[model samples]
Target chain A: MDLGALFGNFNNFLDFTVGGLVIGAIYALVALGYTMVYGVLQLINFAHSEVFMYGTFAVAWTFVLLHGTGDASWSLGRAVPILLVALVAAMLMSAAIALLVERFAYRPLINKNAPKLIALISAIGASFALAEAMGLRDRFAKWFGLDDNLANYVAPNKARDVYSNPVSIQPHGLFHIGGYSVTDVDLVVVVAALVMMFALDIFVRRTKFGRGIRAVAQDPEAAALMGVNSTRVVQVTFLVGGLMAGAAATLYMMKIGSTRQNAGFLLGVKAFTAAVMGGIGNLRGALLGGLLLGVMENWGSAVFGSEWKDVVAFVLLVLILLVRPSGLLGEALGKARA
Target chain B: MLLEVDGLCVNYGHIEAIRDISFGVEEGTVTSLIGANGAGKSTTLKTISGLRKVRAGTITFDGKDITHARPFERVLMGISQSPEGRGCFPGMTVLENLDMGAFVRKDRKSAAYRSDLDRVFDLFPRLKERERQAAGSMSGGEQQMLAIGRALMAKPRLLLLDEPSMGLAPKLIQQIFTIVTEINQQGTTVLLVEQNAAQALKRSDNAHILETGEIVRSGTGHELAGDDSVKAAYLGGDL
Candidate 1:
């Protein structure tokens, strides 16, 4: 009945597919962090998106400090060095933030054996606290002593301005391969995500510390009996997981070229969905799930328009759960089947 | 003494599980706690292994006070426990479970525990056959063997076992008891909790009888097993 509609703009399908793959890679990266922490702790780390958001804000703020907060202070030529600094700063910020969440919020609840609801409340509280601490633009600026400086940076008028440039945010400049054009930023995001994912896989599989992690994930009580320092193991898990979220945040900022105050919220939701799609405790599953979800959302958007992208993930998530509650790979929270 | 528990008490919220329980395990000896259900036998082992807190008492292992230690810290202090109900990681492979037994050994790469792993495999040859199989997927007796082997991997100075004979066939129970003796002879001190009174008493060097959160009798295993009241109440008849 709709043969013309089906055949129309077939090339658009290819473009959306490639674009979806890139987004999927980012989701996979973020999802792996979620999966890893969930694998060991059995807590959702509800503030994890805050961890990612902090990474983004830290990188952006650090760049401002390094390049001076306003127009004509820096050039795109300095991208390489600024990129490194942002990554390192984001990582440090995320690790510190995650550790603080663990120390102030989760650890106490765990000690008290507080019901699951309490932990969830604590997570939500922590998320709100962290988000508001930075989102109340004037208050954050005052506390951090960057009020006037940031205001000027984001002012409506400036030459070669990053903050005040435009209301619409879109990636530009593309390198063509055959008939397809791939932007440098998109390539960087995709490649960086894949590279980090691969490295993380190797670290988990090849290192002695990785074995210790798996051991704890399998049975923390038993692992403790073997002289494995359970506390240290948990801290390290948070650190590594935080680091991944940090890297993903940086890539997101680079690809999107702008980050809203609550940017990590939607990204986090999608990534968490990806994690569940793949199986919450399975590492490779996170990666596969992220890609599948990204592709599904892209195709959905092509058919139904951009507003439906988020809905696509939700639909897939519900369908997957109904079909296989344990997820695509069948892992439960924190207990690896090994 | 390899290990000692003096006046150990434990409470499960409002209910008192154990009160003023005392026992000692000599080095290279099998010390057993035998009792009926709800008699605090497992509770006593849990107190020693640091899984349950001691409300008012002391646990000393090789001259170190461990009453206030954390559970994992107790493992580092050379106390390993194979908990009641076979607390094996069901999702993990048999070999992975064994590797976890050696979790506290930082230098496992160069120790006899490495070879001891092989010995465990030899003792439970069925496990070796299913080394790569998921433990939760295994039979009940096999999971029990995996639990014991995993505990042994800690190379524990004092091993606390809570009901090793639970949920097993009589033949498997005998095999587990024999393994307990073999482990004791291999130089690890053992504190065993069991409901298999006759078999436990026959194999243990020393035994304690618990009834309703209190220790009512203590002696060499033979002495307790030979007691007329013990025979009547626990052994099913005069022996």
Candidate 2:
């Protein structure tokens, strides 16, 4: 709509492009959770959003515990250890929550031979319960009589936005593409995400557990005939998805600096959108969909006011569904073994 | 006996697939269950391999009661099946599919693994040719061979094969039966379910004729093939 402004400000467009890619990397990581779970279970785990949310809190709390609520940035030497600690914390917490959901919420219904729609309803319920439990942490802490000791983690903003300790490492200049200076933060985000993605791809393609997942995905009965325990495969699927969401959460907190109890809701929806856009059960498709969505959303925001960013993203999703419902890759996890 | 099914009954949501079926598969023998469609031949094999629930009676394999065992447990207990319709993992390469067959074995790096792999390749050289190709993209005959070869990779004491010749050409079917006979000769007991009555009867040392989920007749391969009634009903009035 505003082509003149977009063309006139080419430098701003470049900045937006870089920024989009950085955020897109996070979306891709989170989208892996959706795609992998769908690959094995053929169910959209609405509760996966909360898995990411818990990870974001883990990252924030790890920072709060390591460095007090101060605006002091850590030097590169000091930050590396703390960042690694936070990453592990976030991944572990998220994976635990994901496994819990699988065990308590989904497994019961699955064992009962319940319909997919019923499992979906259960996921929605689990999602709400998880978000609400985080939102009501202050009162829950009081019930445990540890509210005063854990005030930093539970207080002041139980139901509101919680800010992470501003221990952000200042970004140095990295390289420039097309006259746009890319920062170290951008490189880290993109590189870390890509490494995780490739690691997951290799694990799925080469490992024995990965083979079990693909077997179950292709044919559960046949997989059983091959001696693959479908239950174990399902657990591994959830755990892997959760780990990726946690990784995304850490990157998101690094870039955005704050989170809410309900933070994962919108982002989870967007990641699911990315998964669908890429190909619901395909690994590479999630990465492609996330990056494409981010760049297009940014461009649309610039052209038609920032308010229309979500509109542009959703409209793109609708258009993609209309044109190719199977997604850009048009292959499920079973067929995308390569 | 390598595998025994005594008074086994299986149901598919109230429709009995197999009823009161009792049979014993002697070790190192090719035992065949010949029948028309819906006669429960496949169902009987599926129940024995632990894929289907038995509503009544017990399945004892190598003298261990496996009636309530899980499918994976059955495999671990040295019983493997190439299920009906040749249930190959379509997304995986032929080598990967074969590897999956040996999933229960922790000795993948041992010489036994190599020998099993070599044996499968020796049995069906076509699978070795398509080692890196996806199983789903292969022809039906090739898929059948891969399915049987995959089952063999498990190194089972007994192999349960369901309709290995279902969709193959006549020549391919003959080749598959020859391999089946060869596999039996190489010290693996076989329980084969087939609609190819003539071919099954020719190869089976002991054969049973199933009708409406029950065993209507049991005899040696020569006895049933020589019987005039069986020749008219199942052998199309000749051979």
Q: Pick the candidate with the highest TM-score.
A: 2
Question: Per-residue lDDT of A82-195 in model 1, one digit per residue for the tens?
Answer: 778888998898888888888888888877879878887898899888876656655555667776667643332221123321111245547764445777667778888889
My TM-score estimates for the predictions, one after another, are 0.91, 0.95
- In candidate 2, what are the lDDT values of residues A69-158, reduced to their tens digit? 677775445777777898999999999999999999999998778999999999999999999899888888888998888888886445
Best by lDDT: 2
Where model 1 places Cα greater than 4 Å from the true spot, the runs are A1-7, A70-78, A140-178, A333-338
For model 1, what is the alpha-carbon lDDT of residue A121?
86
Tens-digit per-residue lDDT, B32-51, candidate 2: 99999999999998888777
List all candidate RMSDs to the true structure: 3.5, 2.0
Query: Across residues B181-206, which tens digit of lDDT does each residue of candidate 1 receive?
Result: 88888888888888888988998899
Candidate 1's displacement at residue A21, Å, is: 1.4
